[model samples]
Target: MTPRPTKKSPDRGDARIRLLEAARDIIRAKGFAATSVDDLCKAAEVTKGAFFHHFKSKEDLGVAAAEFWAETTSSLFVNAPYHQPADPLDRVLAYIAFRKAIIQGDLAEFTCLAGTMIQEVHASSDPIREACGRAILGHADTLVADIEAARQAHDIEGDWTAESLARHTQTVLQGAFILAKAGNDPEIARESLDHLDRYVRQLFKLTEENKC
Candidate 1:
């Protein structure tokens, strides 16, 4: 058999991760338009050459950062410990609790990086807009699956289908983040989610009779 190629050093991966994390922190603090390649390089502690070696352009880095953030944030749902409970409503409630904790936590990072970037770059950059769309779509799809499972588990009654509800939920959450960022209050975000919680509770009440 041919000899195995040498293992790629982890340094590159580490550098990339550092760059993405730095980008997230910087973008969260400053909008995409205000953030520059130099800022990212300084924040990441990597040289401009190193940054360019991994990313073709600042726009490219923005796209990659969106994907990186999506993948990282999606893990919160995918790897959540709560998978089972008699009431499917409980799983959904657990998800809401997790979301609340994320918003109210110390970092107090309000809106999504992709959302912020999209708002800043949508007028000028097709790539960034597309990246933000994909990030949002991925999140909506994940929510759809969970909502469907919860609906089936509890037999909830609503006029909307899983996908519709999923989109609605995503809209509410995104708007909540915007409000939170604009108002500089995580409590506002939590308040926005409260409406959703009420809706879910109503559905749960109706479905109780259908429980096996």
Candidate 2:
């Protein structure tokens, strides 16, 4: 199905933002390679001229889309309720729980834009792949402090650093989305997160009953 844009039309000057929003939704559904410039223009309710005015090429738009994804999701995770917990471990677990909870509605709604884009363009486009990588890794960076804190608080012994574990969280999530897509079930994504939650719990020497 051709995914509908999140909005119909913006006021006169918001075309760029609308196009990026359209790219986020459409690319998540159809992927970067499959989604054409014409498709984006149609979804954004803008002309082809307007798209080229903002983005020099489709590749430029792909880079911008990845950066946009990073900025928007960064704000969301920063302000999320998961960060409210007093305990670092609680915060970490809460983050996992929050990820699991948000797996609702359409797959395109909850899946990572960067993940989808990177999987498709990683081999073919250097700039787009880097942009997508930065977005994914940068988001993973947000979890590092909390993971490190939990590690120290629990004196957790391991070969892994907070950074590696943080990236691993994304790995699990991206893999989960792939599984969800393959199985055509959102629960598959949630179930992968459940395993992630358990892994973190075990890493911190906490039991299932002790989960936050």
Candidate 3:
């Protein structure tokens, strides 16, 4: 009987994914400006030839990593309980609750990769900055749509617009994540959300009056 030819494993594809994951970690720990192709290779335990084979340059890898972060994390927000709430305001509150849970539970120590990179690289690397900008704006749009839905659902009266609320929510959350990382305390994020929750209450009351 003739021996069947052996099939090669798909190690190259796996290596590319490994390099991506390692790049995320390294960039998260050391801002994009500080991270280098050599650092990524060492983190992934791969060679320069392999890294270059998968990515054209360090900037190329940064762009890919930013896209990955957006796709993955934005899905989390889009799929969370925010959209399924009983009403619009409740839905927005639910989104905050979702973030609070992330802080207290499984996602405790991990700061937001997109937010971190945006703060560090938005003024510098155009590709990464653009990617980060898209991620932030996409997430904000989702939140804004949710807020608009709630405004219609509960018939709330308010002077504020959904766009404003969404932008405010995103900024507060991003700032909280930074403070949490710096202080090494997840509660800091939750505490920031508490203030946001209070602001929501005031807005809700104003909306009830149609003063907005």
Candidate 4:
């Protein structure tokens, strides 16, 4: 049986959104190759004809799914509470803590949609892989501002640019998901995120008192 990835469903007649939602959830639980158009149609409760009307092929759906995931998730980060902190450094740490706090339930529930898809199909599906890459890097760009601000305010001189550090968060996160899946526990992923938090703290040269 295909994993039931989500309970949310779009309103009737919104076939495209249903399919896209189904694609995002199911593809995370099941690899892209293992997740078929029929699986998506069944999860979406949409007929095959309806699926075809919106997407010409499963690969097309995959591309659209990656884009949809980017749009939806990027919006979430934009308004997240972590950005509320006044200090840029505090915001950066809060961002990492926010990432840590969300690790719960089944691996599929918390793991990234784009990371899961590209990990499996990057070799064979150029369009889907590129779409996933954009989704990942696009989100990484959001952190650059805070990281750059923190670096400038602290006069933190280093070879690393804020852009590279921002992308590293994704690298560590995607790796964390893989490790979590392999270890069969969500806590395993949190362990990696903990290391990330400490690493960021060290870079900022925060003492024990300043950390608070």
> Best lDDT goes to which candidate?
2
* Tens digits of per-residue lDDT for model 3, 13-115: 5767667777667676677778888887777767899999989988788888878777767666666766775666777887877767777532333566677
Report backbone clashes per prediction.
Answer: 0, 0, 6, 0
How many clashing residue pairs are found in candidate 1? 0
The TM-score obtained by model 4 is: 0.94
Off-target runs (Cα >4 Å) in candidate 3 are 1-10, 104-108, 157-159, 206-212
Q: What is the C-alpha lDDT profile of model 1 across 1-212, one tens digit per residue? A: 01112323346557787788878777877888888999988777778998999999999999998988888877666777544545556766666656666674422354678887888888999998999889887777776666787788767767878788767777888888888887777888888787877676676674556432
* lDDT (0 to 1) per candidate: 0.74, 0.90, 0.74, 0.88
Please identify model 1 stretches exceeding 4 Å from their true place.
1-13, 105-110, 204-212
User: What is the number of residue pairs that collide in model 3?
Assistant: 6
Error of 2 at 110 (Å): 0.6
* Residue 181 in model 3: lDDT: 77
Worst 10 residues of 4 by lDDT: 1-10
Best by TM-score: 2
Q: Give one digit per residue, the lDDT tens place, for model 4 in 1-212.
A: 11344566667678898888788787778878899988998988889999999998999999999999898877677878999988899999999988988888788778888999998889999999999999999999999999999999888988899999999998999999999999999999999999999999898898899883
Candidate 2 at 195: error in angstroms?
0.3
- Badly placed stretches (over 4 Å) of model 2 are 1-8
Candidate 1 lDDT for residue 160:
77
Backbone clashes (count) for model 4: 0
lDDT of 1: 0.74
